[model samples]
Target: MITGGSSGIGLSVAHDVARRGASVTLVARNVSRLEKAQQEVELTMSKLSMDGKVQFFSSDISGSVKNISEMVKNAEASLGPVYMLINCAGFARAQKFEDLSPDLMKQMLDINFTGPMVLTQEVVRGMKVQQEGGVVVFVSSQAGLLGLYGFSAYSASKAAIVRAAEALHMELKPHNISVTVCYPPDTDTPGFVEENQTKPIETKLISEAAGLFKPEEVAKKLVDDSLCGAWSSTVGLEGFMLTTLCAGMGPITDAASFMAQVFLSGLFRSVSAFYLWSFTRIVEREHKKRLENKKSE
Candidate 1:
């Protein structure tokens, strides 16, 4: 089961996993978009000649706990017990802290944080009852690791996901359930396009250094990591360094990864300080330019 499975990373994951013969239930809000995504998934399955069932549920995941619960129940009933639940239905509205509206903040928390939490609760209940164990993947962001100038609300919401997944990892391990949280850098998606419209100059400049990734690339890595029961999934060198630096009490199931984290974390931290300084300079320069323009006016 994948939330936000109608597009972006979620939809790509659906295609990759389905190609690997996993039945998928895509949960999204727009019926038309869901239908379109379902068709795309079906086409992929056909091309791969994989016998995988693809279904979709059109419902607002952040709206009601009861409704989401019913939706999950229905999905499992139709698609069989969900072996994996990927929380990928989220959006970002980048703006400066002073410019962020109250409603927008609430919306971010509701959609990015609360929605996934609620859906995971509902699905995990079934996972526990079945006693078969399962995988829960949370699609967090790079901002979740390090807060950025224009992403106050978004970073807060995504940061919640990282901590929640960390706690869930410990709790679910006894039940044979594994939780993997992915920290993906900016990806080429509809959400990224929308986010860029209001993204602060500092935020944009800082993130650009990390580079953008394709949804398919991120999805493939996420799926493979989750299947391997990795505690954290990251893409590229930047992502790996950030994950290691910010790991902080999070589960480290792989010895080699742990060793890398311990050895490279300090070096990365020193390198990150330079990036932090550069971002601070950008913010200050932008602010000064705005002030000078106001004075001229």
Candidate 2:
């Protein structure tokens, strides 16, 4: 089951898993997009000559608990118990701390953090009972690792997912359940385009340092890492550095990740200091420009 599976990285993940002959259910709020995504998955399955089912569920993950529970029940009824639950149904709204409204903050927490938590709770109950266990993937962002300008609320929400997934990883390890948190860099998605429109100058410049990635690339990496039960799924050199630097007592799923984090912490710390300095300089320059414009006005 892939939430936010209507489009973007989520849809691409649906395609990736479908290629592996996994029965998939695309979950999102848009019925039309879900229909289209379902058709796409079906096409993928057809090409591979796989017999697994492709389904879609139109429901808001951030809505009432009862509704979300029912949606899970219906989904599982259609496609059997969810073996993998990818919590990808989230959005980003770039706004400065001062510009963030109360409603906007609440909405970010609701959709990005609480929604995934609630859905995972519902699905995890059944996953515990299944003998084969399961896998859970949470799609967080690089912003979650390091808070940046114009992402005050968005970073908080995504960070919450990271911490929550850590706690969950400990709890579910005994049950043979694996929890993976995917920290994707800026991917070329519809959501990314929308988010860029409202980004502050500092945010835009600081984020551009990471470079953009294709959704298919991100999705493939996410799927591969989750299937391998890797604790943190990311892409590129910078992603590796961030994940290693920010991995604070997270589940040590592999010896290689542990070794890298142990040996590279100091080096990454030095590198991150430089990045932080650059980001601060950008923010300072932008603030100076704004003050100059205000004085002229």
**Which pairs clash (backbone N, Cα, C closer than 3 Å) in model 2?**
none
- Error of model 1, residue 181, in angstroms: 0.3
Clashes counted in candidate 1 amount to 0
lDDT of 1: 0.91
Best by lDDT: 2
Clashes in model 1: which pairs? Answer: none
lDDT of 2 by residue, 1-297 (tens): 999999999999999999999999889988999998999899999999999999888999999999999998998888899999999989999988999999999999999999999999999998987556999999999989978889989999999999999999999999989999999999999999999899887888998998999999999999999999999999989999999999988999899999999999999999989999989999899899999999999
Q: Which parts of model 2 have CA positions greater than 4 angstroms off?
A: none
Model 1: lDDT of residue 138: 97
Question: Residues 1-297, candidate 1, lDDT per residue (tens digit)?
Answer: 999999999999999999999999999988999999999999999998988999999988789889998998899888888889999999999888999999999999999999999999998989999757999999999989988898989999999998988898999999999999998999999989988998888788888988999999999999999999998898998899899999888898999889988899899999999988888998899899999999999
Show where candidate 1 strays beyond 4 Å: none
Q: Candidate 2 overall Cα lDDT vs. reference?
A: 0.93
Q: How high is the CA lDDT of each candidate model?
A: 0.91, 0.93
